[model samples]
Target chain A: MPGEHPQTLTRSTVAVRSASAPAAPDAETLHEIHRQERASVTGAPVTAPLLPAERALLRSVEHAVLDERRLLTATELSALAALPDSAVMALASLAHQVRLTWCGPAVEVEGILSAKTGGCPEDCHFCSQSSRFDTTVKATPFLDTDEVLEAARQTAALGASEFCIVLAIRGPDERTLARILELVPLVHAETGLNVAVSAGILTKDQARRLAEGGVHRYNHNLETARSFFSEVVTTHSFQERVDTCQLVREEGMELCCGALLGMGESDEQRIELLSELQDLDPTEVPVNFLNPRPGTPLGDRAPVGAWEAVRWIALFRLALPGVILRYAGGREITLRDLQAIGMTAGINALIVGNYLTTLGRSSADDLQMLDDLRMPVAALTVAF
Target chain B: MTQLPAADSAPAFCTGCGQSSASCPGCGRDFDPPRYCSACGRWMGVTVTPSGWTARCKEHGEQHSA
Candidate 1:
């Protein structure tokens, strides 16, 4: 965390301890410092299609930190993350540094189970589960609570620090919510591992209950940029997702939000997506490349190149500086031979083994990837 | 302006070629192709006018005179 000069450190940090007052941005000089950041983007190397002015504007937003401009124009942000190969790598390296300085070398391992697979009502082109597509994936109802608990125990034995129970529906209904609530305490008592949930769009009351039920973090992916969201999902509005994230936060639980790259979204769209996630100030951001599952609307969509993925990771490090950038889904298929190289590109956390709908690389392979990077996962574990 | 929904209801249309075929016929977009024309090997959405192949890249949507 960048330390503010004592005089500049707003008294609000102390005030938060005494009462709940909004913290000022240190001082107005902080805003001026951010204003100057816009000039740096101009220094980006030349590329076809991208104007130097656009590059500069992107740099301004991509490099924006706490004391600087707090946000970027949607157009500028898209350009920053959408750079071709090497340039993207450079940006990713910077992003990694920012993430490291703020977070640390800690890599959190989590196990994810799609409690209810397939059968989604929303028409999100990226999802194979949506009935709108001919994905042909079977939809199952809620899993038995006992079955879910057993999976949690297995995850704990496998050395996973967290177990994330996910469902494919838009949101959990009363019955499903009740089922999850019933098992939360059992999983905690038996496995002793932190539990998280991605039960879909949540309300304030539901979010509060989940938190009380020992759901440490609530994952609700923004999926893509607001501008591009409608093109990806029609049944749900972008603001609805944002509101759900806000609800999770207001309940005092950690907010986990991330985006899926390579859905034919423009680089500007990717940047805008990250910028929006930054605004919400999530505790963790899982960066995933589009894997293009067959039968889904985006099945034919090409995956983002390995180097491009690396660059996005680096850019994330620079922009957020302090947020957790977990390299989630699509690592094996997207990064290929360069899987280990991702660590140096500024990735700190990783999702080991299997993902929700797809099988991941073997846990041994992941352990080797970490060992090859010579970056030890920090032992100071975080539950949320 | 209203943001377009991320989900495109239209069946997968080859972005490279204007053909509304279900998938790219793997025309010129092979592993390698002519440098002068990015979409030389790929499906082309626009017609080959008197000028040559006139198509827009899926990402930039810029008119490319190949």
Candidate 2:
């Protein structure tokens, strides 16, 4: 029995298409990762926690995700989503456990710069950059190379391993692409940090060029579910954004695809979006809440409730156990003092400094939160 | 003073320090940058970056979020 080989293992053209098979994990991946045990990051699970009326439903989810490490189906996720406020903390506890088991304790710190602010041609209802909306943001040309380099330097100083250069455009044109191509290597060379680009949609050639030129990841958000997309943006179809993400993956770069919540989409829609995100197979998912930019169509929308934020953060983690689930953009307004709750709720990464247009809480405060939680940040390059 | 082009031209009761009422406790506790100068009821032109924010009140000069 010990000497027998599987018949399926003899196939010539196996599932893996790589010219070479993947190498086994080194010490860093095997030993250094998952450094903590027993989900010590979050304190003791809730005492006599209020659970869903259907306790078995929660039990089944825990069994599938925790025991088997399988993704949750939309049906499983929605049942948890509809659970009363009483059962949320328990759900969060399970989500936190899934995160600890799957992702480990190392938190990825990143800083984002709005390289080209405002003046977008598209009409995204929740965006301040859209020219269709009479917003406070003014159209500005791209930042100079020096400015971009300085921002990257500052980002590096924060001990950030990743820096994203974001532009407020529908898609980067040839001229814009040239500037980005020049900057990606310069930023990486200078800061020793991976650079991600979020210059709207990308053509196949552009994605390949960026991939070949050393761009680490591409940021393109599906924003909402396909069914609810037309309500949020009139200019671009959700499929186009999906195609761009597909191209990024085809060209061999990590996809930093994300979603924006609280745009009045139904719970069913949110689950639908989660399932869709699973299908896309992103390495990172930046969970953004609608902060409701003024003058934009959705300016008056209310901020997502803090508890609701925590609940979804957990759901996203459970839904995509292997993703670098990040707390992005709206956490400042959405979670406020309860921000640290997200760390335990399955967020292994966050944008520490100011968001693109809105002001974020101090970097010192965020660093302190990580310190208090005893969570190890990946880099310790510079002290604030 | 140029009004904050923010959709809601009128600042909320929680806009800044003096504007706080019993109903809205203001941002001193919550720590949001002031969008309007409480002294003159003027919208503060705000530029927010990772470092912090600078809200410029036409008459009151500038307020930095240290």
Most accurate candidate by lDDT: 2
Per-model lDDT:
0.65, 0.78
What share of the reference contacts is kept in model 2? 0.33
Candidate 1, lDDT over the whole model = 0.65
- Give the per-residue lDDT digits (tens) of candidate 1, residues B18-66: 3444455423232111111232223323322111223333443434332
- Collision pairs in model 2: none
lDDT of 2: 0.78
For this target, which candidate reaches the highest TM-score against the unseen true structure?
2
Q: Write model 2 residue lDDT over A297-319, tens digit each, in one string.
A: 99899999998899899899889
What's the C-alpha lDDT at position A195 in model 1?
80
Candidate 2 residue spans exceeding 4 A from truth: A1-48, A51-53, A379-384, B1-48, B53-66
**lDDT for residue A233 in candidate 1, whole number 0-100:** 88
